[model samples]
Target: AYPILAKHNIKPDYVLALERHDLVYQCFEQDNQEFDKDILFIIASVAHKSVIDTLEKTKKSYILVHRPLPFSKALHMDDYGYLGSGLSVANMAYDLAIKLGHKNIILIGQDLAYDENGNSHPKEYLHTQESENDRKEGLFITAYGGNGKVETNQWWILFKESLEYSIDTNSVTTYNATEGGARIEGSIEKPFKELCENLLRENKPLFEKPQTLSEKEIQDKKDKIDECLKRVVILGRSYINECEILKSDLARCLENLNFENQDFNPLSQRIYQMKAKFEDEEFKNYFLDLIRSIFFHFEYKIAQNYTKNPTNIEEEYAKRKEYIEIHINWIDFIIPHIKLQIQSIEKGLS
Candidate 1:
């Protein structure tokens, strides 16, 4: 658009801008209309029940672009609008120009902020402002590359096509200004500049330095684990007390204990070992299997003997207490080794 306007040395009398929001279209209509006036109409989707009445009542036209599906997908167009390689807003503008039946359309203020005069938009503007009495309201050409290294080639594609078409004598004149977007490339642009004026900030500095912990940090972790162990031991006693309450019925008590012990033992041991094997991972799984088998056996025994031998409850309590003490000794021995493992980890980290 900028190239076309520059080729003919013509500044546009009317400009047509398209956005999806009707309210925004209305704002541009009312406010900017008093300034270097151009007709700005919102091409809203039929899906949005936007202020259609206001659009209709306004002096400018409010066109509805119909689509098969609802307009949910188009909401993210702002983020991905630069995806196309060559064809972008230029193609759209061309279509729009043809649709509006305008043979002599001219564009302005689209200068993408580049200069054929060996200057960037800022430098040129600063020089111009210093020398000229009155500042120009807008630029005339559309240029793409910014101060950043990561260049967007989409603008190049648009400029390529725009320049090629501007050579035609019968077509619209395109004028490109040096700068276009509100910010440099790769910078975050807030949706509404006025509303988010204070919210937007400069990009955060990247942290490239390595992060490492000190020897003291590693030792501190060991001390924390030691503190945790003491609390766990206190709670272990409470669990033992709860286990004692179910000891009155020998079969029921054994079944409950068997289920509890199965975590350290398993049913597969009952078939292969016929007894217990201790300490190894295989032994641990076997132990759980053995406990499950015992639980099953006790349940069967309880159902069979409960009616005839209900008074065997006293003997059952004694046997249960004996096994409880055995478990406590096992736990006391295992705790010291567990503490050693934690110490080893701390030493390794240090």
Candidate 2:
């Protein structure tokens, strides 16, 4: 506990744990509140059931925890799953810090375990392990690889992806003791730093720059979308056999809802075509609409909450505004993914 906390050199308002491991709790107990009482210590893990059962009698805010909701797994598996937990950490930290009126927060030891020798401990071992005994069983784990070099590439990939997904205008200076994972991945594995850096840099110049499309670029995008669409149309021919069965189920639902135009074929086909051969112009319009719609929904939700039942008036107002701001920033992160996917499809067509 001392080593872990000391290694980071900074204290978190909340210590989030997937499981109430004895060690984690011990650390929580030993550590003095360097931050404020507002910083919550949350414990969440699959094994939290046992802890909750045992400590049911005691009511203390110090040991606050939440279980992973099963339904949420469908949409947010990556955010809460084994590999996704790292991303969750960054997200939670950022949220907690922002709530506490912090602007610049440091991300501590997000380093990945190195693959020294041929054998090495995997970072995901915690999520994959079935029981406490299993995690404990791996104590004698050793590596077979010859070189004793540590590689954090895998951990870095997930960390960067998460940070990209969660980071906002707030300045987060990640203090990496070793080589920063983002730099290594961007430089070595792929020539993606130009794109990633442009998107992530805080100067705001990139955002303020004019978004004008060249004729050649538009034409190129059009040709690629055409080719991709043809492939999707072809694929739909193969799905015709199952269409009859699926339609029956779909029709029943539509009818029950008192829908008039019961036509899934055209809608499904259109969506397939759009996904396969997306028109840059059409996509630009559609994506903008989609994003704006999401933003509108978010704004309305926030506004409704603030206007209606007012709880934690100040905190709620701050959170509602902050979340809306995060949504806009998140749109920036999503743009690259959309562009890349479109580009990949275009290249495939070419």
TM-score: model 1 vs. ground truth: 0.24
Quote the lDDT for 264 in model 2: 36
Give the TM-scores of the predictions, in the order they appear. 0.24, 0.31
User: What C-alpha lDDT, on a 0 to 100 scale, does residue 160 get in candidate 1?
Assistant: 45
Instruction: Estimate, for each residue in 246-284, the C-alpha lDDT of model 1 and write its tens digit.
Output: 222323434565433342233223312322323334333
Off by more than 4 A, model 1: 1-17, 21-26, 29-61, 66-91, 113-350
- Scored by lDDT, model 1 comes in at 0.37
Model-by-model lDDT, in order? 0.37, 0.40
* Model 2 lDDT tens row, 72-113: 232232322331233445555545555456434444333333
Candidate 2 lowest-lDDT run of ten? 135-144
The residue pairs found clashing in candidate 2 are: 18-44, 18-45, 114-151, 117-145, 118-144, 118-145, 119-143, 119-144, 119-145, 229-277
Cα deviation of 273, candidate 2, in Å:
19
